[model samples]
Structures are given as C-alpha cells and as structure tokens.
Target: MKRLMFYCQHILGIGHLIRSTEIVRGLTNDFQVCFINGGEIVKGFEIPDKIELVNLPAIKTDTEFRELQVPTGFQTIDEVLEYRRDQLLTAFNRIQPDVLMIELFPFGRRRFSAELLPLLDRAKAHGTKIVCSLRDIVVTKQDQVRHEEKVCKLINRYFDLLLIHGDPAFIPLEASFSRTQDLNCNVHYTGYVVQQGVGIREQKIGNGKQAASTHLPTPLILTSVGGGRFGHDLLKCVAEASKVLETKIPHHIQLFTGPFAPDEVFEQLQTIAQHRHNLTVDRYTPNLLAYMQQADLSISMAGYNTTMNVLTTGVRSMLLPFTGNDDQEQTIRSQRLEQLGVVTLIRPSDLHPEAFADRIIECLQTSPTSMQFDLGGVKKTANLIRAIVHKQPVIV
Candidate 1:
C-alpha cells in the first residue's frame, strides 16, 4: 500500500482537527496513513485504528491568537519549536510517504512556517507528491496583496495539489483569495467534509418513512461552542436565555460547552442549569451529530465542522460567528448560509437573555427550507489522493 503522511495543526479550535480526521478516515482503505496532530489532544476524539497516530509536542494559542502556549509540558516556546521541527523532519525521513497531505498551511497557520517550510523543502527534495487540504474560507490579513502573493509563491513552489473542501457553487476560493489564477498547482474542490453517518436520520424499509429517533419528549434546543477555547459568553447567555424561556416556551435546552472550556465556566453553567429542570449542561460528546439529528432547533458558533453538520442534517440553526482577531471566515460563512434561507444570524448585540429567548422561539417555530450541497467531500478526497499517488488520471 502507498504510504500517506497527513499533517494538521489546530491552534485555537477543534474544527480543523475534526475535518482532517474525517478526511483521513476515508483514505485509510487505500493508503497507509500516518496522522500528525500538532495541537493539544481532545479526550475521546476518535481516530481510526488502522492509521498510525503521531502526537507532536502539542501547542495551542489563546483565543486572540496572540502567542503560543505549552499547555502540558514545561518546555519553552523556543524549545518546542526546535523539537517539533526536528521531529517532523525525522518522521518524514522514516515514513518516506508517497504523498504528504497538509491542512491549511499557506492559507492559514502561517505562524508554523518555522517547521512547515523546512518540511516542505525536504519533501520537495524527496520528490514526494504534496497536497494541501483547505477549507472553504480563509482568514483575511491586513496587507491583502502581500499575503496573497506570499501564499501563491509558496503554493506554486511546493504543492502538487490543492483540494478545497467546499463547493464552488456556494463559495469559491476567489471569494476570499482573489489571486486563484496565480497558483501553479492543480486545484480541486471536494465539497464540504462532514462527519459520516452520525447526523443523518435513518429510514425505515417497510413504511418508506424516517424511523423514530431518540429525541426527547419535549422540544429540544441544542447549543454548542466548538472546542470551548472561546465563546464562554455565548454559552452563558444561552443558559440565561433558557431561564427567560422557562415559563414562556416548553422546550428542553442542552448545552455542549466543548472540551476546552475552562473549569470555572463549566461549573458556572452547571450552577445555572441546576435551578431549571428543562436545562442541562455538559462538557463534551463524541456523538454530537446524533443529538443534532434529533434536535428541533440548533444554536451554536459558526465553525466549519458545525456548519457542515447543520447543512448535512438540515436542522434549523442560529449562528453567532466568532469575530475575534478580526477573523471574518465564520461571518462570511454564516452570511451565505443565511442568504440560502436555512439559518438565522445572531449578532453580539442580541445576546440579552430576554431578547434572545424570543429569537430562540422564533427559530423553533419556523421550519428551515431544505437545501442541497456537495457533501461528498470525504469519498472524493480519497479518490483524488489515490489517483495522485498512482499517477492515474485526476478525476473528481
């Protein structure tokens, strides 16, 4: 079997890690996969047993993306950088993968250039086919022209293929990166990579109808913050909103604060939930989609993976995009989804509990119009990689 080494670094959110693991799951049947995770591990995040897992010196950033923090070990930033760089090079030398797949390097995660640039050069020297796995939207920098130019230069020099995990009909690369015409590598859109078979409702064979799900007796309102590194205010507001709606609306509220939520934040949410019988709060769940599949309404921050789950499940959703560090990726995505008439956008100004309860009620009462997207990203990505590794015709 052809060996493929996949590298992913998620500094702030778990969306990147979730999406990368989903893509790697599809490639295991065709390729011997070595999955490289450079972020702090989220407990209970599943990886395929067939793949070799490499956990590098885990590092992450604050919510503002200001500086890197060594979450567990006592090593300083400089030591971690040097050790991580050497570790990546040594892994590349040992595995000698036929294809090197990187997630969001030139488009995002620019701070890791110290290690990534060297690894790219070494892979180029070894004649290993290089692929870039990117999401639909990219973060905008201050100097737009200089940023795009640098990205184009690096992509053209090192990359063999750029697989964008989104549909062009919805949003293309040029929407964010204007200079798509500049890159020399082969680019393909693989639609949106979604968690397989989790959020979808099953069908019954005899009645030709959807089977009954494990839904709660009352109306279910599900809210989550991706990774829990940020978005404390959102969850807290949701808890307060539940109290406001306690007597007005007959609904059960469930909150998934994510694995990285601070201990104090989780405890506070639990305390708030203690007073309300209709409200419950938890830290993490491996099967979030299953709950989303059965939910009457979904409320959460607009991250790539969660949005994909909403799209996949066709659930009624309200999204409050994270605007930290002037990041526009989530807002851009949320706006498009709203335009499609499937989701409602929540502004920061609308976080008041009494007012937000009305917003939640409005969403629960209105059914979302069904829309279709190219959600076959995982299978298509596997096919593209197989073709690239075997020198077969590139077909998507």
Candidate 2:
C-alpha cells in the first residue's frame, strides 16, 4: 500500500480536525496512514486506532487567532516551532510517503509556515504527491488578492492536486480565493463531506457520556458550539432562550458548551440550566452526529461540519455564524444555505435572549425544506486519491 502522511492543525475549534478525521478514517482501509496533529490536545477526541498518529507538542492560538501559545509551558513559541519542525521533517524522512495530504494549507494555517514551508520542501525533495484538503469556503484575508497570489505560488511550486470538499455550484474556491484562475494544480470538487449518521442505540456510550436518550423530549432542540473557545454568547443566548421558550414550545433544549469553553462560562451555563428541567448542558460528546440525527431542530454556528449535519439529518436549523476575528467563511456558507431554504440564518444581533427565543419559536412553527446537496465528498475523495495514485482515468 502507498504511504500517506496527513497533517492538520486546528487552533480554535475542532471542526477542521473533525473533518480531517473523517477523511483520514476513509483512507485507512487503503493506505498506510500517518496523521500529524498540531493543536492543543483534545483529551477524548478519538482517532482510528490503526493509523500512526504523531501528536506534536500541542500549540493553540487565542480566540482572535492573533497569538499562538503552547499549552504546556515546556517551550516558548519559537522553541516549540523548532521542535515541531524537526519532528515533522524527521517523520517525513522516515515515511518517504507517496502522498502528503495537508488539511487547509495555503488557504489557511498560514501561521504555521515556519514548519509547514520546510515540511513542503522535504516532501518535494522526496518526490511525494502533495494534496491540499480544503473545505467549501475559505476564510479570506485582509489583502485577499495578495493573499491568494501567494497561495497560488505555493500551490504551483509543490502541490499535485487540490481536493475541494464542496459543490462548486454552491460555493466555489473563487468565492474566497480571488486568484483561483491563477493556481496551477488540478482542482477537484468532492462534494460535501458529511459525518456519517448512526443509530444512537448502536453506540457504546462510553466515558459517562450520555447519548441523546430516546426518552429526552418530544421535540429535541440541539445546540452546539463547534470548538467552544468563542461560543459563550451563543450558548448563553440558547440557555436563556430555552427558559423563554419552555412555556411556549414545551421542547427540551440540549446545549453542548464545547470542550474548550471557559470553565467559568461552562459552569455559569450549567448553573442556569440546572434550574430548568427542560434544559441540559454538557461539555463534549463524540456522538454529536447521532444527536443531530435525532433532533427536530439544530441551533449552532454555520461551520462546514455542523451545516453538513443539518443538511444530512434533514433538521430545521437556525444558524448564527461565528464573526470573531472578522472571519466571514461561516457567514458566507450560512447565507448560501439560507437562500437555498436549507436553514434560517440568524444574525449576531438576533442572538439577544428574547430574539433568539422568538426565532426558535418561529423555526418550531416552520419546517426546513430539504435541498439536494453533494453529500458524496468522503467517498469521492477516496476515489480521487486512489485514481491519482494508480494513474487511472476517473471522473470526480
């Protein structure tokens, strides 16, 4: 089997890492895979047991994405970068992978260029096939034209193919990266990579983590913040909204405060939720998709992964995109889906406790129309990679 080395660094939320995990899991049956995780360690987030996972000294950034910090005090940012760089290059030398799959490089994770740039050099030196695993919409930078120009330069120099995990008719690479016309690598769209849906009963429910019980409520409202670093406002709104909507809707609100949420914030939400029998709040659970499967409605940020869940599970949704750090990727995605009648978009201002409660009531009164989305991303990605490796003609 051809060896594949995958690299991903998630600074704020687990969405990127979660999406990467799905893709890597699909590839494990075919490739000798090595996954390099370059983020603050998530204690319970599980990866497949078979792949060789190299967890580098974990690094994370502030909610603003302005400052990079080491979770462990063993090294300064400069020292940690050097150590991670050496670790990555050493792994590269040992594997001499036939394929190097990078999650969101050039398009994002530009901050890790200290090590990533050199890692690319090593891969090229070894004649490895380089792939960029990107999401549907990219987070555009301030100098977008210049930003995209540099990205094109990097792609032309090293990458063999770019797998855009989205339907171009909905949102193309050109939506964010203005210089898509200038990039030299082959770009293929592999549809939306949705998390697989499984029956909640089939799961083992380990770690004292409660599954979305069959007995919870008549109509469950699932609310989640993808990574938890910046969702306090959303969660707080939902917690309060549940109280407001209790008498009106009589539905249960299940809130996931996210694993990275501030301890105080999580505690505060828990305290507020405990008084109401209709509201439940927790830190994290691996069975988010299963909950989405059972939910009557979902209220969360419009991140790629969560949106895919709404689309796949056919759940009515009210989306409030994360606007921190001036990132418009989620907003762009939510708008497109809203236009297609897949979800109702919520503004930051609309997140006021009463307004959110009213919006939830509105959503409960209405049902979302299911729109046909390209949900073949995971399978198509595997096929595309396989065809490229074997030099076989295939349609994307």
lDDT of 2 by residue, 178-271 (tens): 7777778888999999887655553212222465655445588899988899878889989887778878876778888888998999899889
Highest lDDT: which candidate?
1
Off by over 4 Å in 1: 71-75, 199-215
lDDT of 2: 0.86
How many angstroms is residue 292 displaced in model 2 relative to the true structure, after the best TM-score fit? 0.9
Model 2 misplacement above 4 A: 201-215
lDDT of 2 at 72: 74
Displacement of the residue 382 alpha carbon in candidate 2, Å: 0.7
lDDT, residue 2, candidate 1:
91
**Could you tell me the TM-score of candidate 1?**
0.94
Residue pairs in candidate 1 whose N, alpha carbon or C atoms collide under 3 angstroms:
none
Over the full model, what C-alpha lDDT does candidate 1 score relative to the true structure?
A: 0.89
lDDT against the true structure, per candidate, is 0.89, 0.86
